[model samples]
Target: MGASERVVPEGARRRRRPTKGGTVLSEQLIVETTLRLIGEHGAAALTVRRLGAALGCDPSAVYRYFKDTDELLLAVADELIGRTLNSWRPTGDWRADLRALGLRMHADYMAHPQAAMLACARVTGRRHEIRSVDAILGVLRGAGFPDAEAVRIYHVFVDQTLSFAALDASTLALPVRARELEARAWRETYARMPAETHPHIAATSGVLVAEMDRSGYPAALEMVLAAAAGRLAHVRSGPPGA
Candidate 1:
């Protein structure tokens, strides 16, 4: 097919002009396909050839939607954000809403850890990324935070959520054997530390052992939300001009 007949049109990636008699692909179609590929085969599975095979188009047609794998990767990442945010409806309680949102993001990342590891902390400057920032800021502002405080709290909440997601995703993205070894160490080593030598470790051994098979995102997320809650409480209690 000719350049003008390709899915993205001749001038820009934003255009969704599908080719004549070719498999009609759009940016959304390509992104959805990319996400599925990553979910099934990990981040290493994405390539123009593979995507073309999956989409029933020429490999060159894949480039009609994206300049390269890196660019397409950003789109995939942004799609995850869009999917998550789109599914979330805000509750009036800010703390509960924030907690739920954080957990959702953590779960979403865990579901596609390789993709999360690649894009969790990335600043995509895409529509979904912008929407995510707006959503969080709206939550804080709606909860009665002043503009500056809302902005600061939004940064803390988002950074904490994405950072923890990235860390967990990195571990999940590791090869199976390596992850098994790490789990073994967590269960065997930390759970078996001697009381005399490490009283705190021994005391917490049960929790540690149980957590060996768990993602620590929930507890860490709770801590972050609790901190924000305290800040909000303190601001509410401040004297009139102080």
Candidate 2:
């Protein structure tokens, strides 16, 4: 095989790509570009060839920074987590703080709907994710919930936040016409359902038409916070070991 065609060893740094318009490649640049491409063309646009093309480099160069596409994607997911938590300051009121954090997370994810759809369910296990987990645990523990209950509530809080983000993002990610169709379904189809078969839906159709198109994350977040507050009250009311 020609020396020029030799495969680069894993973890070995490759020479920088010859500059095109003096643009240099870096992990941050690659991630940002990937996000832009995903935003422009959806998640399917995230392949190595497309990324390299966008960055003006060989596809192999991406492997130097990320072990594989999955690793790169995890980094992208971590970036979203980082953006959500960046410069976040807790207000010392657990409920208020959590509500703010949850809202911030949902907003950030919705801003990058295509990326959120791809990443919301991933563990990431990267630095940003680790920090978020620690920060949330601290919030729970700081609220005076016992360790066990805190952990349980943290699981529910994070999962519910991400799940709702992904769910809402899917709607946002749809093509404009498709989204319009979905909105029309809530207003037209459900609102016009037969009183004989879907009596409840019929009776509540007016409310559903008004509400169904809206994202449910805020209400769901409130319910979670309320449940956690109740749990904390119960724990405080119990004996120490109870």
Candidate 3:
């Protein structure tokens, strides 16, 4: 019989069909499962073998979807970006909208503290991510920024927000052993500082320690937005000589 005319065995044909809930695995499923695993066990506990086990498949199944761990991390990062964009609504006021988006992004990363570290520097080139960049650039352009200036500000805004979020999450998610060591280091460093040699530091030491719990993310984001707006205004008002 011709290959096209050959009939499959009854049991083999049945096996080829998807079960009610066992549809063909997809990238979304993988990414969602990865995030859930990271949330439950932390990023360090995530491995291809473990992830597959959690997904009821073999490690090779993941490779069919993602090239490697880095690719998977990038997909996770893209998923995070999509989540942030979904939560942010852009009001007509560019600065306020941008600030709101930054705050939301920070909070989202803080919620998924473990994933932040892995995703901080990844650029996934996903569609929604590109649209986000375009939206921010459009906002800046509408606010009278030159294309070049808008692009620069976009980079600054994204990098600063993500970097800050990652740093905050990493510090907060430090393992118990690491946290104790960090505390000891802080005590030793402070003890070694002579009051006269560092009078300003000594005076503010208590305030600094006490204010560590204060939310600096919003303040820092505001500062960046203000600086960018100021620069844009200056560029608009000044001539080539100025």
lDDT of each: 0.81, 0.86, 0.79
lDDT of 2 by residue, 38-75 (tens): 99998886788888888888887777677677777888
Q: Rank the candidates by lDDT, best first.
A: 2, 1, 3
* TM-score of each model, in listed order: 0.85, 0.90, 0.80
Off by over 4 Å in 1: 1-23, 240-242
Best lDDT goes to which candidate? 2
lDDT string for model 1 (29-128, tens) is 8888888888788888677778888877667877677777777888888988988898788988998998888888888878888789888878899999
By summed lDDT, the worst window of 10 consecutive residues in model 2 runs over 1-10
Q: Mind giving the per-residue lDDT tens digits that candidate 3 earns over 106-222?
A: 888888889988888777898668878888888888888877888999999999998899898888788889977876664666545678898876777766655554557777888
Show pairs that collide, candidate 3.
Answer: none
The per-candidate count of clashes, in order, stands at 0, 0, 0
lDDT winner between 1 and 2, please give it. Answer: 2
Give lDDT for model 3. 0.79
Q: What's the lDDT for candidate 2?
A: 0.86
